[model samples]
Target: MSTTVLHARTLPGDAEQRWPARLWGVLAVLCLVVFLDGLDGSMISIALPSVGHDLGMGTASLQWIVNGYYLGYGGLLLLGGRAADMLGRRRVFLIALGVFAAASLLSSVAASGSLLIATRFVKGVAAAFTAPASLSLLTTTFPEGAQRNGALSVFSLFGALGYSLGLVLGGVLDGFGWRYVFLMPVPLALLALVVGWKLISRDRRPRPGRRDHADRGRRRVR
Candidate 1:
């Protein structure tokens, strides 16, 4: 009789690993970055009066300043998502954050209304890439079922909090200078980039064989 040792295979969902504490830290960093994006988006709106005064922008130009950023952001979202999927999410997220920080810096240093508006358009494009990629990364990192639900809930809560905080912070920063609102995200984005690079490892799972093939077939049918 031959004796054989058999090891049990754990299913993806059946793995008994608990949520690591580092995951929370990563999540918090992601939240802060997302919050900054939200804050920056609204900060200009609240500070428009001050901005117009400083830059001598008229009403029509002011409207263009705001509208241009939105148009750029919304128009590029689909492209951003596809890019995130094609490139690595982590790589794209960091690149977007870098672009966003650069744009914020430019906005802060802008001497004219047109310069500021142009910077805002760049920032919006950067955000289009960063936001969805960050969320998709979080979803992919966290295990599914209860843990994933909890993580998503926390992410959503931070998003809501960021929006409310932005409104309050915008008012306060407006009193100081309109530039500070734009400058604020620079440090936060930097911090997030650092933490994300240090703590998050690339996903190393081998692509599922049959499922992947089936998915490709479905896509072809579509």
Candidate 2:
């Protein structure tokens, strides 16, 4: 049997019919990361009572498990953006994905509310980096206008659908243990890490513009 092969759209800039196979793979990985991020928050919401029961959490502190994640995620948004710029988007994304996976593993086995909350915070922090980096990477990889718009639509659809699916998944996994909710994302993260590593292109950064020139000019004048 002969199999037909489809070529990928050129990595950003070519308005073409067949997209690069690697581009689709990269999009899947990026969308998976976002999907898991959205799912983690929603899925855990359904498991809170179970978590509280197992961890012996008080009402006051139980809220923090969720809030802790938000705190780390929201607070670090700016820092994560800067990190993607300075640290390199692909490198930062991979590191953050690892952090998210590790934190999920830690969260699954946490013996105390303190530990669980801390792990959630860590996951959220990782998410902060992953979100922007994924978006930046996606846009750059796809061409402007229709191509980028289509990619964004797919990315956002995953995010929206993840929340919906998470609730159902949370209920199903509840039979196993609330820990499964946190534990589940770990595999997805790992898979994304692998796919991303293989498919993500090594991008050359554009040079800094007027800021560098101005500084050099002043230094030379002095």
Of the candidates shown, which would achieve the greatest TM-score relative to the real structure? 2
The collision pairs in model 1 are none
lDDT, model 2, position 150: 91
Candidate 1 C-alpha RMSD relative to the actual structure: 8.3
Question: What is the lDDT for 142 in model 2?
Answer: 94
Candidate 1's residue-wise lDDT over 1-222, tens digit each?
123322234444356556677898778877877787677766678888888898999988887767777877898998888888888788888899899889989988899988988988998899889888888888888888788888888888887888788878889988889888778888888888888888776745456799899999999999
lDDT of 2 by residue, 93-152 (tens): 999999999999999999999999999999999999999999989988998978789999
**lDDT (0 to 1) per candidate:** 0.82, 0.90
- CA lDDT, candidate 1, residue 121: 92
Flag regions of model 1 displaced more than 4 Å: 1-18, 203-222
Worst 10 residues of 2 by lDDT: 1-10
Clashing pairs in 2: 8-19, 8-20, 9-19, 9-20
| Residue runs of model 2 more than 4 Å from their true location after superposition | 1-15, 208-214
